[model samples]
Target chain A: MDFDAIISNLPLYLKGLWVTLQLVIMALAAGFVLAVPVALAAASRNLLVAIIPKAFIYFFRGTPLLVQMFMIYHGFAQFDALRESFLWLVFREAYWCALIAFSLNTAAYTAEILRGAIEQTSFGEVEAAKACGMSKPTIYRRIVLPSSFRRALPAYGNEVIFMLHGSALAGVITIVDLFGAAKIVNSRHFVPFESFITAGVFYLCVTFFLVWLFKRLEHHWNAYLRPRETIAVPTIAATAAD
Target chain B: MRKLVTAVVTAVTVALVSTSVIAGEWKKIRIGVEGAYPPFSSITADGKLVGFDIDIANALCAELGAECELVPQDWDGIIPALLAKKYDAIIASMSITEERKKKVAFTNKYYNTPAKFVRRKGSGIEISMEGLKGKTVGVQRATTHDNFITGEFGEAVDIKRYATQDEAYLDAVAGRLDLLLADSVAMDDGFLKTDQGKDFEFVGPGYSEVKYFGEGAGIAVRKEDQDLVDMLNKAIDAIRANGTYEKINSNYFEFDVYGG
Candidate 1:
């Protein structure tokens, strides 16, 4: 209700906003890169290659990300040797631990989405490319990958939004994302509604911007599907006449 | 076809009605706790819930002639969950702050501890604000410790907030955090017992800021449950007057760690 109090905390909220954005951007980029290979393996004909990635996806997806984060951040530290080892440097910071957990979890879901989209690509297009004497690698590169990416775009957009929301969990492990910042404010001010509502608005703005961007990308990719205006007008007239 | 649809709908309705009736029958009084604060409440190695809060809660329930069940809830969601009737009350060492008082009623303070800072041994760090400048300090999220650290250190210190006290302690032990700020009793239990904790030490004199820290740890109840709060306060006072409070206190903490 106190607009001024909420306005005063804008700087802290902005700092949190920055951290949330960084986490989402970094996690999405790294997760996408990791997902491409996993998706490829999942779609591969070889059982061994396919099974390994499938298991990785299954384990990460089956367990909650909070548990996965704890396992990576705390459970991994339980071993004395791990603490004394060189890898301790990476696992020591909460930021990297959170980044790792988010990336792995996102990778699992992204791989599944990409795999679904890749499989949904038209078989006729591949046959046509083969008839043109295109090699297997060339056909995949020129046709399959592009079509799959286009088909996967919408799902990938959803994934991006999910990752943004997931970044809120960074606060659990000690990273001061937006939710973390709001929590600090809430604890200090004892105004949960004000702090949380401010944080929620920030998230809404970020998600809204992302949705708009994705919609634009979807329109751009589907430009070919837009019927020529002249033909569309005649077809509509003919249908009306009929 | 219509008769089949009607029969199916009747069956579904009967099933749902029975389920609700069964759910409405109270078997136990569910108690929600953060489970991250040690000595007060924490998860044991065997995945069983144990600690001072658990013992006190069980004792209180026994005194009230009611069955008790423990529910692990995140600190941030604890109060909301209680309001939503996810649990009957909160026994999570939740301080009775004035702001929170607006939402829920609380029994009298049961336990209290001064806030302190813990840095690695041989780190040569003091508790002074200047010493903590640009240093990463860890504190449990949504706690008075978190509020105090941020207030005292401000932008000078990079405060890392954690959902649980254990997580912050782990980070401190792993050297990710320069210092750990928490309730003195909690730090005493966490750092004084563990092998890694042996290398950590509390710095300077512990203190409390009443404005932000609130009163002390107390059982949180619904605002409408004034009768329940009265019963609890009476039991709490009785325990404190007798040797019961001291007995429980000595089991987990040294000296008298009560009052704000």
Candidate 2:
């Protein structure tokens, strides 16, 4: 009911939203880069290459992200060597620690999502690539990876939102993301409703934006699934209206 | 038609429960305590909540002639939990601030302590803005200390806020923080005197400014529970007048912690 409180705290909410966006974008990019190799290894024929990535996936996916963050941020200091080493500079900062934790955690989930999408690819497309004298790596580069990415769009879109929400936990380590700003506001005003509701709106807007974005991407990439009339030139206005 | 019947029954049940609650008098009370702030209220290794705050809660309950049920709640959620009726009162060492007064009522403080900085034995960290410039200072987030540091020295210092005082202490031990800011007694008895905090000493001067530190930590209850607040204040006065408060004080500190 306190509209003044919401209006006055708009800047704080914006700052928090920006931090959350930064964390999610950076984490998603880093996770995607790391996940490709991990997905490849997990889908490999070799046992040794597959087991290590599998174990990593299980470890990160099985444990909670908060616990992993604490281990990297607080647990590493227990070692004398680590404390004295150059790595301490990176490990000493809560921001870097949170970034590392998010990147590693998201990589696991992303790898699994990619792996599932990759498995869904038809054998015939791979056979066609083979018939053209394309190497395994060439087939993966030209056909498997691109198609799987398109197939994985829906789930990956959900994960982006997941990472956004997860970024709220970064406030626990002192990085003032969206939830952290709300916490500060509530602390000062003791009005949880006003501050948290404002933050909830920010989250809602971000999520809606992301959902709308991926819908357009899905429309463009999965043209075969769309009507032939809309295939030649996908109009932004149509997608936006939809 | 069936949905309407179900809704009618639910509404009737809810009304009955509300009427009984409003008409009833206070009997047994549930008290929420943060079982993490040591010497005030913390869980022992055996899972017992024992500390100065817990003792005061028990004494107040005895004075009021009511059975007390203690609920351990995390510090961050303590206020929300109280609002949600998870407990009737919060006996945690929550500082009595003007901001907090809007949400909850408080009894007279059972104890008062200043905030202080803890650092390495020879760290020579400055407590002033100029001295603390660019230095990392750790504090438990959402606390009066966090607010004070951020509001007062935020431009000069790199403030690292943790979820708990213990986490700040851990970071200080690991050399990740140049200084740790928290309640003087909590740092003294809870960490500074302990083995984990042996390398550290209470550095710089203690701070008890009303603006930042607020009033001393007090028991908080819903504003609607004014009667409970009055009852607690009377109980606090009775114990302090008698020898009970002093006995408990001695068990924790050598001096009168109330600063009376």
Candidate 3:
């Protein structure tokens, strides 16, 4: 109904989209890096090695992301020691707090995904690597981790999309992410439907783009799982015999 | 004789009840309130809603002889909820802005207060464009204070709009905010009086710019609720004349909130 309002507020929405993009991309990158070591630790045979990482993953995964963010943003700020300490520079800003919360939360979830994939790593593959006299660390590097990453690709894609939606919460801490921009526009103009619908459209577009991007990534990563293309090679050999 | 007296009393009581029911039309009314702004309307520790606005809402309902229900709503959604018929009236400390008048009718202001900025004591922050430039200022989202700061100092200040006054106060206490702009009374009673606000003090002079702050806080209802508006206006007058308003006022503030 308010096309004009939507049209005029595009710049604000674009600005918000940029913030959202920055937050989600940075969080996902950080989470993925953290998850690799966490997944390895959690998938360990020794309980002592695994318990701490397991607890960390469960703690982040079980609680609400919003509460985690509030605890970091609002809860951490209540401490005088933390405020006076050198870490206060990072803890003082809402952007860093949100980024920390998002990264930790996604890391927990991704660690579980990678852990499951690691645990399900084909025994035959590891045995074959050992038969070749590959060392434990070398085996993990050359065989186990890469295969698990390939296995984890589809689920990791889903996690990435989930993280994108979760990034909307950044606005709560006063970051002008996409949803925050919509709230500002709605409050300024009092046109809730127009403002929010525009935000929803932006989210939908990003989500669709993520889905397409992941589909491509999955196709490339899991190419080994697909049936081999023998038809073209067989046809060429038959022509040579003729 | 006792039986006859009981019968007579019952008859008179029933007659009074019937007459009052007939005279005071709207039987059931729902009022929306923001349970976040302290000393105005906020939830207590045990989850009971208490404050001056709650007291006034109760008194008005008593005066109207209507069963009232108070619906705690967030500030941003309060007006939209009223328009959507989520509640019959909003007694939240909503300023009677001309912008709001386009969508809803307002009763005469039940209370009025000017907006002010608060910062850390001895911070020596000047209330000017050059002084506040690039400084982060927090305000409750969608409020008259938000409108004023965004309009008057949007370019000069980095405005952080919070969902509630409490959040803004929290940020101010956390030192995340360089300044906070809110109703002078709310900041005084809600934050500055609290232990967390010990280091903070009001900075700029109180602002009551007619274009932004409007004519104080009023009871907001749907545009079609003219009859309800008239009834509420009359009840407001009755409470003021009968000293009920003063009793509610003194409970929250030391001085008059019914600004001239």
Candidate 4:
């Protein structure tokens, strides 16, 4: 209720906002990149190719992110050999540990989403491509991937927002994200509601921006679907003639 | 539709099972404490809960003629979990602040210690706000140390908040933090004894702001548990009078650190 406290703590709130943004962006980018091959492996027919990534997705998704973060940051550090290993350089820092956990967790969910979308792509499209004598690699690159991405777009948008929210866990491992900063303010001012509300608003703002971005992306991707003249039939007819 | 029904039925079954287990009668009192706060409460290597609060909780339950169990909860969630009925009472070294008084009741203070800061020895750091400029400091999340660092040090030092004092201590030892701020007794008993904190030394005079740090650590009970609070307070007073408090205090700390 006090505008004074809110105004006074704006800088700290901004710092938290920045930290949250970094965590979300880095985690999402790394996770999406890792998710592509995992989804491919999961969808493949070969049991050997599919089993490992399938298990990885299942294990990360099954356990809570808090436990995963702890196992990586604190639990693994208990081993003296781990400290001496090359992994210590990354494990020693809380930020890297949180990043690794968030990336893995988001990758699991993203892979599942992408796998579902790839599976849903129309069988007719593949049949048409094969009828045209299109190569398997070409069929996948041109038809399967694009259509699957379009199908998965909306769901993937939701996942992006979830990843942003999940990044709050970084505060637990000592990364000074927005929640961490709000906690600092609460402890200092003894005004939990004010500080938390401010942090909540910051999160809401970021979420709104993400929603807007996804909407734009969805619109851009759907641009080819806009009703148009049948002139496009000429190009199709030429390809058919060939 | 059959799959939907199965999912719903399974969910309902699981919910009922869990609720029944949680809603069971108060045959045994489960006490919550931050296990990293040593001499007061801590988790042993074998995962058993021990320390002053553990012993006192058992003793108090003996007086109440009830079986007592200890539950380890992170410091930040301690109060909310108690309110959520996850535990019967909190014997953790929780200070009684006026803000907290609105939600929960506290017994008389059984132990008290002023908050202080610890830094690496020969780090050339003095115990003043200016000395901490540009240094990174650590404190337990949702604690008075977190509050004090922000209020006093502000942007002069980097404030790293952790879920446990032990985590903060680990970071401090790793040089991720230049200083760690916490209760004097906790620093003395827990951190000082740890191999990582051997080179760490306490700097500066202890400070307290009643508005944030509260009126020292007391047993937190539900506000409705006025009867329970009275019984616990009586036992606390009796123990203090009979020198049991001193006996427990001296066991963990070399010097008496109670009654700040």
Candidate 5:
């Protein structure tokens, strides 16, 4: 309600947005890297290859990220063996734990999304690549991946937004992300509306920016797939074929 | 025809539930409580809310001649629930502070306690900033103890804020945190006395400065409920004068926690 209070707290929210941006970008990048192989394997014809990725996808997607975070941040520390391990160094830091959990969770979801898109790739284009003596790897690299990515862009964009919101969970573990900043402001000032609404608008701005960015990417990448605006003309084959 | 009947039934049901609250009477009331913080409020094994805060709420309700139902709520959303009219009053051990006064009204404090930090028995950690440098300390988020440590020692220590005091205690016991901060009485009865918390001991000076702690824990109501506030305040005074407060105090603590 108090615009002045919200304005005064802009610095805190901006700081929070920076932290949120870092988490989202890092997690998305990591997830993208991991998801590529998983999606590839998931799209494989070999049951063994497909099953391995499927299991990883199933586990991460099945469990809640919050539970995974708690298990990493607090649960593993409960064990002496884990404490003695080198992994403890990363596990001890809430930042790393949260990032890993978010990355793994998003990777599973992104893999599934990419897998669906890959399955939808045109069989005609694939057959054309095969007829031209393109190897499996080249076919996937030049034909399938590009087409699948273009198709998957919108859904993946949605996943990015969900992950952006999901990064708010980092606050519960004390990462000082956007929602964390909102909580601090709310706690300090007892102004929930001013505190949360400020963060809400920032999230909205980020979402809009993301949506616009994805729209541009889709427009350019899928340009060839679009129906061209053209003048009606008779083809030369109609007159010459007979 | 069935869909039309269903629509009519749903509308009537919604309206009846919406307007059912008995206005201007304390005959029946819903009290929000977090049954997680032990010794103050917690859920027993049999699913009953049994603790000092519950006893205090019961005493207050008896004084008001009202039937009170203690609704368990997450501490994070307790205030919002009160604001949303999910419950009339909060009997959670919510500290009374100027910040809180901006949103909801609080009755006179039932009890007050200093905040303290507990560390491992053999850890040799001092409470000073230099000694606590690079050490991880855990406290429940949004708590007075959390604000105190963050305000005072944020530069010196790595503070990990938990959603609940119980979570902080668990981490402290598990050695994930070097130390944990919380209400002294809660630390004493809720954790330090428990088997899981046996490895840790209070290591810091108790913090009771009014600037950080404000007044004691108070029953909270919406700001517009002045009549309810007055009635609750009178009930609190009556409980104290009639020794009901003393009885509940003795049930929870060995010392006077009224903060007077």
Candidate 6:
């Protein structure tokens, strides 16, 4: 309702938007890259290869993102050994702590999605690739991975938006993300409704944009699965064939 | 005529007595207290609320012969909750600030303490602007200490505000903050004396400027509840006079917290 407050604080929100975009984009990119190997290992029949990734995924997925963030930012800081370790360089900064937490958490969720898609790869598709004398690596690189990505696209899109929302927790750790900006504005002006609604609108816009982006990606990648278009041939075409 | 006069007098007396009963008696007082600020108010592991504030509240209620109910509320929402009638008054160590006076009224301060900055014992961080430049200072969000630091040293320091004083202490212990500003008594009793705070010591002079820290911690009531405010003020005076306040103050602190 306070248009003046929202307008005056526009720059703050924009700065926060930048931080949020950076966190979400970096987290998603990092998560996707990490997810590929983990998903492959998780889909593997070899217990030794699958067990580690499975445990990693289970631990990250089972706990709340807030707890994970706190564990990294506050919990790890409790140990003097960690504080003295070289890893403290990364763990000390709240921004990096939030980034690492978001990346790991999203990586787990994305891996699970990809693992499901990989397992659901049609038996015939692998058989056909094998019959064509394709090696395992070539089959995976040329056929399995691409198809799995297409199948996982919708679910992965959901994960991207969820990560965006989850990145709000970064603010709690002291990073000035979008929600943090709103909190600062609210605390200063005591306008919780105006401040939070502004943040909510920003989130809604990003969510809608993500939805549109995913829709286009899905359409482009699943083009082969769409019903084939019918064509009418002129009588001259039949004559030409003769 | 005499009989009619007597009947009217009796009716008027009955009405006056009933109205006084309804308006004057604060029989059950629901006092709001933040259970996060330890040594002042905190919830124990078993969930019982106990601290200086709790004891003081109970003593005040007992002095007034009213049954008291302690409602634990988050510090951030304490004022709004009071306005919404979540409780009759707040016994939390709320500074008697000018900004708070616009909405809620305050009883006379029961205890007064100055704010101070704390840091790692050997950090040698000066309290000056140049000295604290680029240093991260932690404070409880929305507190007078937050206001003072943000207004005075915000440009010089990276001010990190937490929802509770304990969170700020946690961050301070974690070495995330170079300085911590809060009530001297609170930081002394709540954080500094604890094992996690062994390395930290009070760094700067105590800040008790009336403009920033206000007149000290007072009971807050709704503006409309002037009667309740007056009653609580009288109770505060009675307790202080009866040595009840001294007993509670000594239980949590070593020195006189009711500042001159």
- Cα displacement (angstroms), candidate 4, residue A30, comes to 2.2
Error of 6 at A172 (Å): 2.8
Question: Model 6 residue B28 lDDT?
Answer: 83
CAPRI tier of model 2: acceptable
True contacts kept of each: 0.48, 0.48, 0.45, 0.28, 0.41, 0.24
Better of 1 and 2 by TM-score: 2
Ranked candidates (lDDT, high to low): 3, 6, 5, 2, 1, 4
Tens-place lDDT per residue, model 2, B133-171, is 999999987789988888889899888777678778888
| Candidate 1 local lDDT, A13-119, one digit each (tens) | 89989999988898888999999889989998899889999999999889998899889888887777988999998998778889999999999999999888778
lDDT values of the candidates?
0.83, 0.87, 0.92, 0.82, 0.88, 0.91
Q: Which tens-of-lDDT digit does each residue in B147-203 have in candidate 5?
A: 789889989998887778887887676667999889999989999999998888998
Model 1 TM-score, all chains together: 0.75
TM-score of chain A of 5: 0.91
Candidate 3 per-residue lDDT, tens place, B1-260, comes to 99999999999999999977753477888899999999899999999999999999999999988889999988877887888888999999889999889779999999999999999998889899899999999998888999999899999998998999998888888888899999999999999999989999999799998899999999998888788999999999999999999999988899999999
Question: What TM-score does each of the candidates earn?
Answer: 0.75, 0.88, 0.90, 0.69, 0.86, 0.89
Better of 3 and 4 by TM-score: 3
lDDT of 6: 0.91
User: Measured with DockQ on alpha carbons, how good is candidate 4?
Assistant: 0.18
Ranking by DockQ: 3, 2, 5, 1, 6, 4
Runs in model 6 lying further than 4 Å from the true structure: A1-10, A188-191, A228-242, B1-24
Docking class of 3: acceptable
Best by DockQ: 3
TM-score of chain B of each: 0.86, 0.90, 0.90, 0.85, 0.91, 0.91
Off-target runs (Cα >4 Å) in candidate 4 are A1-14, A37-59, A79-90, A116-141, A181-216, A223-242, B1-35, B43-49, B54-74, B77-91, B95-109, B119-133, B170-175, B194-238
Give candidate 5's whole-model lDDT: 0.88
Clashes of each: 0, 0, 0, 1, 0, 0
DockQ of candidate 6 is 0.27
Model no. 3, DockQ: 0.46
